[model samples]
Target: MANQSELDDHYTRMDKIFRLSLGEKGAYSCARFDGDFSMTTEAAQLKKYQFIEEGCKIKKGTKMLDIGCGWGHFVDYLTKKGVDAHGVVLAKGQADACIKNGLKVKHMDSKLITPETFGKFDAVTAMGSPEHLCSVEQYREGKQEMIYNTYFKQVADLLPIGGRYYCQSMVFGPKMVKFEDIKFGQTDLWKKEFTDEELMDIICEVFPGSWLPYGKEGLINPASKYFKVVSVDSGRLDYIETIHRWTAAFTAFNLQKYLLFASFVPDYLFDKTFRRWMRRFKIQANLHVFTREIFEHYRIVFEKVSD
Candidate 1:
């Protein structure tokens, strides 16, 4: 899994850009669109949440936990509907914001979640979290499958028989470049001198210490041990639309975000690590990967059927 520091580097420090671009309580993950991209992103996000609510059979009194709950948007939404919604975020900024907004959230590691910690939840959702379950180093060490399997077991431990788990993640797609082709920590200017494969390497540069699963099966296979697959849907197009919307907002003038970015100018000029990190924004690498299907998004629901 991506360590706390790496996560903070990407999420905590850049929280403003995310919030500014998507608004205070916007959905940071891909919104759902059932072949109808015409709807506004907010509407699509509500649809996505509705799908989750129905899939989990959640009601006014249902207890739920949202893992990797960035900004606590879903948490706030559920709470408004009278559900007992709690969220856990690794990013300090997000947790603080949730608290400030009077949302139920804790700044803690998702892996530490257990019955002992917060007791059982009727349903658990891990939106955009599983992508960080395995780091590049862990993959290279051939521990990827074991890591995912263990994660499934941990999640199962937090649920009773028939409990539901909604998990959204980006998995390595067919077009993903070979592992060896990817490079890292090189201070080479963004897009200055890089081949197609090397350009793909910029993914790790932006989301340091994070690696994705191969395909939906990469998630279902391990999860089969403790849960039964309920539904699986390709969210590729929804993500494309979501990215396009976010790109527009990000490129739009935001004094605070720009000023925050400007402060990094000195680091970008002198620090190699910061320079590499900055490269992710120079060209918006996320859109490239999602557009090319180098990363495939999956929205899945799993039912805990066994211990």
Candidate 2:
């Protein structure tokens, strides 16, 4: 698992690139496009927030906390809907952006949050955050479930018995390849997923110290002790669609911005560790869905039952 500082640094380095490619809203998670394949990314994002609000039964005047809130997009949405929404993140870049946008966000670690640190809330959300909570090493060391249990307990502590918690995470799929066994110029994964192992190594460089859960069970079982799993939705296809849109966004960005990005291309090519992951990003989204099936995206809603 990434410590707070490492997570902050990763976001700091990638914030500008993210904003340039992901649009002004800066959503860094899978957008829900249940059936409307032609829906715009922004529209899909709205649908996702709506689903979360409805799924968690959030309404006007409800108190909510958005953990790992990126750029406060959802926080901004919830606030505009008359909900008392607060956000927490470890990324300085994101925190600054949130504050600049006049949002109620704190630059702090979500893991350290407790009732004492950030009062009780009617609901809590953690979109795209749980994937970073446990590392592959942690899972191998037999600490994944314990880590999740502790996290769920903390969330439960912040909510009343009937309060809700929403989470979206990436988990290792049924066909997940062993971390050590993954190779570039693949034999079975995909033909063009990566040109070489250096590109594969860049993924670690990009998301250093982060790892996803084995599967949804890795989350549900631990949370079962504190909350009831009310709903589970597989967003794998939606994520593929979302990434497709993101790639288009990157392509459609103004020429001036593209030129600016191009200036860094040489740097990426020269430094083996710079941005080799960019090449992987080209096919990774679709590859993960169609070929490798190594990762799965899920949205789950939970309600506090007992501590």
Candidate 3:
């Protein structure tokens, strides 16, 4: 188990690596993660918005707060429907992009939020970002419980009695998947070029990420102490579809990069090989679809109880 300093260092390194791999523009483009650029046709985006609207019981002119609002997509969507929407994002690049796109967003961490700066929001939503909490070892050490409790307690404090908080997260799926088995292009090379163990080794070699499929039990159980669970939606199918789209878009982007910069043979070869590996990810995602019991994602809606 890593200490707090170690965990912080890991996150700092991860932030740098992610920013380098997914430039400002590319990351925003892939935020929807299903390759649908048009908002009208974006099933995933639309579903998320729909969930927010329904769960919050939002009305025209209702005030809303979005946590981890990537590129302010949900803010724009809500505002377009006549809801007064505000958002906070930790990524300066994403916030800048949103501003350039004429959307309003505050740059701040979720833990830093308060009713003073944000005012009271009628509803709050966080999508697929809470997993950024401390590492699994920290959770086992009991720090995770305190962290999550404080997070929800803050959200509850920011809302009126009966106000709502909606969240979508990658929860514990049916089975525990090793990080190595799911990484891009490592195992799927030329006819099982790498075994599952080899893939796991490669994952550990390249990254120190972890995956836990706890379903809604851990998050929902604690949150229910302070809020009532109104709805729980599963996203295993959607997640699989999302990954397939991401792999496809990434493949296209890398191919274009290779064609434009052929002088970089090593990079080109890596892209070519990586594309083949992405196909393996598609297979794994599909496997989850068939056995959702072993793998699942969740969208949970909760309403604060008045103190």
TM-score of each: 0.93, 0.88, 0.69
Q: Quick one: best lDDT, which candidate?
A: 1
Q: In model 3, what is the error at residue 161, expressed in angstroms?
A: 0.7
Candidate 3 residue lDDT tens string, 1-307 = 2232332333332333233334332222212223344433256556566757888998788889888776566788777888898887765656666667676688667777889986899998887556555454554465766767777788888899999998777665655455434554344434545444444433332223333325688678668767989988776665665655555544454544545435445653677644443344434533343244444567789998854
Question: lDDT values of the candidates?
Answer: 0.86, 0.78, 0.60
Report how far off residue 283 is in candidate 3 (Å).
10
| Per-residue C-alpha lDDT of model 2 across residues 1-307, encoded as one tens digit per residue | 6766667656766677777777554888899999689888889999999899998889999989999998888998889989999999888888888888899999888999989887899999999888778764676687877888889999999999989999998877776666666452333323454433333343444455666677889788889988998999888888878877777776785866687788887888787545544554554543343235667888999999997
When 1 and 3 are scored with TM-score, the better candidate is 1
Task: Judging by TM-score, tell me the better candidate of 2 and 3.
Answer: 2
Candidate 2, residue 160: Cα displacement in angstroms equals: 0.2
lDDT per residue for candidate 1 within 1-307, as digits (tens), equals 8878888888887788888878886678889987698898889999999999999888899999999898988999999999999999887888887888898899998988888998998999999989888898999999999999999999999898999999999898878888886666553554455554655667787787888999899999999999999999999888988888878887788898888778888998999777756666776677778878788999999999999
Candidate 1 has an lDDT of 0.86
* Candidate 2: clashing pairs of residues: none
| Lowest lDDT block of 10, candidate 2 | 184-193
